[model samples]
Target: MKKIKEVAGNNTSDLVEMNRSAIVRILQQMDVCSRADIAKITGLTQASITKIVAVLIDMGIVTEVGFVKGEGNRRSIGLRLNAEKNLVIGVKFSRHVFSIGVFDIRGKVYTQQETEFGLDEFASDVVVEMKKQIHDLLKKYKNVVAIGFAVPGPYLRKEGRIALVTKMPSWQNVNFVEEFENEFDKPVFIEQDANAGALAEWWFGNHGRPINSLAYFLAGEGVGSGIVDHDRLILGNLGIASEIGHISIDVKGPACECGNKGCLELYCSANALLKKAEEILPELFEEEYENRWEACNRVFLAAKEGNEKALELTEEIAEYLGYGCVTLINAYDPEIIVIGDSISQGGDLLLPTINKIVKERVIPEISGKVQIKISKLTVDPTLYGAAAIATDKVLRKPSEYLVSK
Candidate 1:
């Protein structure tokens, strides 16, 4: 965890900041550790560690958990992050659903709920619903530090507006962050859903090991990826770096809403799965499910039960999804590519096919060591991603937001 410290030809203040960051990151990972252990792990001297811990404790960021017995039966007090001292709100907004979560500094979900929207729900209405959820969470808990929104399409971070959401065109031109901040009067972070999923995996999915680089491929309304290299998230011009779903796989195939011919989303998104299901067996959906989301779930369940048509659809999706992985493998060359979101409900049936394609089609030099798998998050990855965004802000500047109120 000492690697979390950034060294930049250290000035005295910079050096101190680096030590503080390293200590906090270590505490975050370990939950609780003795002062001797912190000093040993951070490579900071006893005096430096003691001074920094005192400052962090004064700032209300770290607290003494309890005493631990060491060599010679000596007892030392353990330090841990005051994770519950502040709260973060995470919202995942899609075409037809809004998922809200309240989380603490350690990525624990305090409470959460999901609400479905009507086909004609307006942007203002969506905002109102979000305000209600945030208000309820606040009513139950105090010291909310920030809020984060996980959106479906490319977001212009500079402009603070959604660039486009193909499934919900009305979301375009909406400055969601501004509106959220105005209502809540707190800092709000906006990010593409896939990128959020990526952050969640990097921060929480690694099981205490550091991930130098990885890509999270989120398949939902559309396919997208969040790319991380050297522990940094890569954002292209206008924060639209990994728009993989819009990448055209077929030059002469069906035209897409992005005005591309045969984009990857047309083949592998949750919507795409339902589209094919309706095309092949219209009656399956007409009589059973009330909406496309449920119908898509039905298809995945059927595939698991060895239904012929359902299995065929899974193979088709795996072929295209795996093809997308090839492109990601070649482009980012991540150590692991995690497939998540609603589309991943197909689980083993879909995962094997995608893995097979990446192994067979990717260049041996690049794919030789790449590991691909399904998401391991017990809670929704996107929700954790939202919390990660806020958690990152707090970690970077404890002085700014982690102080006693």
Candidate 2:
């Protein structure tokens, strides 16, 4: 016990001078631990924990929650992060819309707002509109400390910018972090949306089962995947991995924005499915022109009500998605695959078929253990992801455990 506390104290002291990002790491690991418990767990001396906790308390970043009991009437005082003290901003950028949110270090989304910028506006008008949205939000809650972003395309982690193809022409290769930081005069961080969503699932959603390995499918304006194995996000050498949306299943099929033919998103994304519906029900567009979310939900409800056209469209979408799921299942051998974002509306209609295809395509042994389903955290995946990013960044660093105490 003394040795452990010493180690924890050393770790605490070692990372003491780090900014919020490194501090968040320590807090994330101290979830169920008291200040003393944290000191012991991190192998830091109690004195070090005292100083850190004192600083956090003075800053209103940490607070005493209550007393905790150990194995046999062992009493300890608990500490929790004060998420309401400092506001954090997160923006999830997609081709058609942006999900904006405000949170604190405890991974709570206190406020959420979204704005739609059509395909025609992603470059020229999007940044200006984004600034307007931020100003508008600041009018409501102005204490934003830092901003984190999740962008649809592959991005360079170091520079925090779009590095590769994006359906939106203007955003491609744009150094968003530098641009936003220079413009807003605040620190900025950016990551891939799917990766952020996967981190959200791992940190806030159900990942506690023996199966920590997961494949996260995000079917929004585009389809993408984020792979989590052994409780860590699998970011490859290029800082991008699990881009299942662009996987070409049909060599001769329709061309994709990623310079591929017959990519999964061509058939499975909300945009792709909406486009398919547009060809069949052109009149539906006359109404929900701007807010297609409602219209898309109606498509799912129509399928649920057994509308033949809706059913066919939904099934077509499911088949393509099932193929993508199977590919991910075979490749990653995940214990579970969570589907999130817009396509999750068809989750009930999608999961069974996805499992069926995986069963047919993958090894039966792996298929039996793998569970494929949609995230219950859908309506707020990006929101929660952004909040988690704040928790992770602001708190310092998240340890390997989901509940790290």
Candidate 3:
């Protein structure tokens, strides 16, 4: 019910498809429901529900499961989505690593693998390896219907290129659309990492129902935010809206790769935490860390162990993260804010300080109503988000992408 949006279209066929999408989304959430239940939830007439369900059954997208108790103790046929028959591939591309996974429409992951590469690695070579992995997965997962790709923020949707990646300049010119659009037999959909995270939370997250708006705050290699309002992604003109990482927190702060001063990313990102940790807690860095996440966790672990300096460093990062949350609340007015990514591993050590700052900074009336929680997704949010991007599209037009057994 929370996923349903108001249907609008001038064309009758388009309207019908929209209605079908609504029904499918409901089944995706509820798992099983009667036509009467769907009609009541969607506010559509039972006749329309019957008509839509019949077509969906004919298409093999939906099937009658059996009789189930309906509202008022009445008996009605149960309907459900044939989720196992439709699969998607999720690909997450970052500076140091790229991950690919196979997932069904219901967010069940079949398999995933991560490949690490250096900053100096040829972008073309990395992409080639990525394609090879994806091609291999496609061969093994015959049910896969589409592929979803997630890249760093400020990604130009129209141009299909990252306008600017923090440490990776070579990728800025690698047109993702040109490289991926025709590379696979199945349709490939691309979205910025933050937006993809938002979709992952929207579709797969268990944040309770009827979430009018949700914000996903990403604090890892880079800081960013993604917003989902009323079951729709708030994509700006170039599909880069809600990029909270680029928002300047300090006008006089250091210069950022995004050509801005004091961007939120420079302060709360894993790199920022590492820089401060190196200065105050140099002993923790005696051994080289495999990645930024490991280094950041070292600081958090030290804080948990009662190291005063480590606690201070984590508190500072938490304050910056709190500032990011405040900005998210003011800009998007999300019902819930979900903090995720490498930095979120701080867990309990970070929440108290972050929540305190938010309570002090935001008006009580607003702050009291907003719920903040760390992401509990079993899979990496960005990787799962890649699958969600494809899932969102397939659900919108089931007839075109979803295959019948």
Candidate 4:
């Protein structure tokens, strides 16, 4: 009977909201539980639980279901979150493509669409198209309570502009907050794509409960990471804390777009993998690819089919990814690390080498406790992460976001 600790709030109202949020979060993960069960888990008095549950039930955020057995084997009413009624829109904006999805707080996806744009395409035009599509989805799904946007890092969260985006300099000037904050009627939450991925894995991914910390290593078109410690994102002063991709793996290596030499991104990103793939396996790219994910998949398929060159290339990439994991473990000491995005599609081919490297590089005690795995999210982690961003916010202050029926 380990009790879940609640986050302390500043004031009376804040404490009330935090208590409600804790209850809702438990329900979100557990699906259904009794007031006595919530009280036991949260360490809140039965009276406090009753008051908070009443508010949540009145706010249309929680509903009473059939009876369930309590701690002492007594029957008690079960309360569940009204997740289907509270939806969120997740938008993943990246170098070559943008995706939009509608999801509930429980990470259930209703619909998702992807739009690809050229690197030469105007940023303003892309924003216009994204806004139009979101509007269309909002019109269709009336239950949507908020919107979550995930942009590439090193995104300046406070400034609401991307500090730098490789090969896409034009996007640096666009203030996402100004662009989307007032554009939609519902509140809009913006986060770096990696951070979004972390939140997605934290709230949605099947990683089991009570995770002390989790790190999401994103190795897609761009390289980055997001960290979640104790149900909260580890956002630094400007909300961009874990930019692991820019960490220099080689001090004397080629200069990266971030002005760093021999950065991990240059060695392990989808761009990096494709660069080597095209040189070693020319026939694989005889035709154009719909996206980098597809291009990377071709190489993985080649390796899967026992192509020696492709296998070597994948091992090399996996070794670098392993290096990234080692760094993540030393830097954050997360309970688990999830490798995600396009590169993770090679999990079957990549894990053996990656694990071997980690086993060699890290201490036995540290390496033994840390579990590394590829993301198993059905939707793209970044897109699903966008929804998680909103879901995280809405769950925190249900009264503010969810309307009372």
- Number of clashing pairs per prediction, in order: 0, 18, 0, 0
Pitting candidate 1 against candidate 4, the one with the higher TM-score is 4
CA lDDT scores, all candidates in order: 0.82, 0.71, 0.92, 0.93
Estimate the TM-score of every prediction. Answer: 0.90, 0.81, 0.95, 0.96
Ten-residue region with minimum lDDT total, candidate 4 = 7-16
* Residue 220, model 4, lDDT: 96
User: What lDDT tens digits, residue by residue, belong to model 1 across residues 1-405?
Assistant: 456776558688867776787788788778888889888887788898999999999888899988987668899998998888878888888878888999887788888888888758888888887888888887877878888788876778888777767867778868876787677767787888888998888777854456668899988777899988876788888888888998999999898877889999888998888888888867677676654556777888888888898899989998998998999988888888898887887788887888889879977788878888888888888878888777776676676776463
Which candidate ranks first by lDDT, i.e. highest? Answer: 4
- The residue-by-residue lDDT of candidate 4 on 226-324, one tens digit each, is 999988899999887899999999999999988989999999999999999999899999999988899999999999999999999999999999999
Q: Over all chains combined, what TM-score does candidate 2 have? A: 0.81
Residue pairs in clash, model 4: none
TM-score of model 1 (CA atoms) = 0.90
Kindly report which residue stretches of model 3 are placed more than 4 angstroms away from their true locations once superposed.
1-9
Q: Can you give the lDDT of residue 73 in candidate 3?
A: 89
Give residue 363's error in model 2 in angstroms.
1.1
